[model samples]
Target: MAGFFDRFRKPEPEPVRAELDQAGYEEVLDLIRADHKVPAVKRIRELTGLGLVQAKDLADAIEEGRWAPFPAPGQSLADRVRALLSQDRATDAVRMVAQETGMTEDEASRFIDGLDQP
Candidate 1:
């Protein structure tokens, strides 16, 4: 059986085409499936010709498994680190998120804060 990390790993891409070309769809899917909301939303807008609001909704849906946000952000990643104080882990989490998503420290902090909370 897969662990939490494996569970969140994206399903294999099957070459389905969408509003965007296959490459574009795949790119959007890659970011969305990774749960990189901001960039995924921006990429969705570029690929799907969606407005900002639409893109956000779409990206959120992708995260939620609608396309899901089921596990909550960083919940799985932070699971092992939860032994530390939330504040302590917050710093580590920020670093981890920044490395994974290419967000700055401040941006990663905000996102990690959301995940760090119960």
Candidate 2:
């Protein structure tokens, strides 16, 4: 009579650490903002002049903020996006805010979309 307890138990896998250079990280961010259509990996290559694999590694590090930005003042998205695309992802930005603030994605998207409207 075997009980509900299972015989197999495994430990959780460790997180993988990426070896990233600080200068490369900052350059990737700049490229992403500059060329809106470029995917994360390509932006990394163009900016750092690194090969594909190295570029991707750098981009991943930046997204996780392994090398995050220092607090600073700069241009607004409205201006930046206007230069890039006619319509920007206001909803996506709102969702990101919601995720940080512990609000539901739907609620955050609604809130931001409303703000954008007249």
Candidate 3:
């Protein structure tokens, strides 16, 4: 009799946590860098099936460096910094230079600042 009663109970929906593959992650990063965060969050929700709040949190995490994009193979650090600078991500460019080349933050800032000088 108890077994029969159990059949009427609805199963609870499980929360899904999805991890983005390289391509998806890269796309999200590009969207975020382009200042299209709404689209980025929408993409995240599509890819991960997360709710709006969760998707927004994920996008924020990516922006805050809780996640990192894969580096392009064979790309030099200088080239990468220039690319970031071109995207108006100067702070991120400076951090990348400092991290990869063991330069002080001040040195990295100066290096990035000098990249466009004649």
Candidate 4:
């Protein structure tokens, strides 16, 4: 009976391809050196064609001196929440988000709800 229900669970999202090209490497590094995270993310997205989350991850990695493009999948908080939700652990997911982000319970609930959409 449990096996029957397992077939209907949502699959985890595919990991983002966040490889940075050499063309804009210097410019992106300069932005990071200047402590301009948002602009660095935008520039990374432009160069690598990654999504906002992926670009941000790449930028963070670069800043940390760990610029390897590939890492464990679903490394972001949103991805962790999504993983928990997929496993039918909504309460745990909400609690984890609230604790990690210092969000109120209501805000955390809304944040989890927002993740339900595409």
Winning candidate number (lDDT): 3
Evaluated at residue 45, the lDDT of candidate 2 is 58
Ranking by lDDT: 3, 4, 1, 2
Expressed as tens digits, the lDDT of each residue in 1-118 for candidate 4 is: 9999988999766554555654466578679879898999888887777878878887876665445332246488888778668877686667667767889879999998887543
Flag regions of model 3 displaced more than 4 Å: 1-11, 14-17, 69-118
Q: Who is ahead in lDDT, 2 or 3?
A: 3
User: What C-alpha lDDT, on a 0 to 100 scale, does residue 103 get in candidate 2?
Assistant: 62
TM-score of 1: 0.35
Give residue 112's lDDT in candidate 1 (0 to 100): 57
lDDT of 3 by residue, 24-118 (tens): 88799889989999999999988888889988998998876556555779987778788777777788787777776788889989888787532
Tens-digit lDDT string for candidate 1 (81-112) = 35333535455445555655688889866775
Q: How many backbone clashes does candidate 3 have?
A: 0
TM-score of each: 0.35, 0.33, 0.50, 0.41
* Cα-based lDDT for every prediction: 0.59, 0.51, 0.81, 0.73
Model 1 residue runs over 4 Å out of place are 1-18, 67-118
Where in model 2 is the C-alpha error above 4 Å?
1-40, 48-54, 57-88, 114-118
Put down candidate 2 lDDT per residue, 19-118, tens digits, no spaces: 3344544456566656542476775555546676666665665554344432225845334323223345454355344545566778765555455332
Model 1 lowest lDDT segment of ten = 63-72
List pairs with backbone clashes in candidate 4. none
Query: Global lDDT for candidate 2?
Result: 0.51
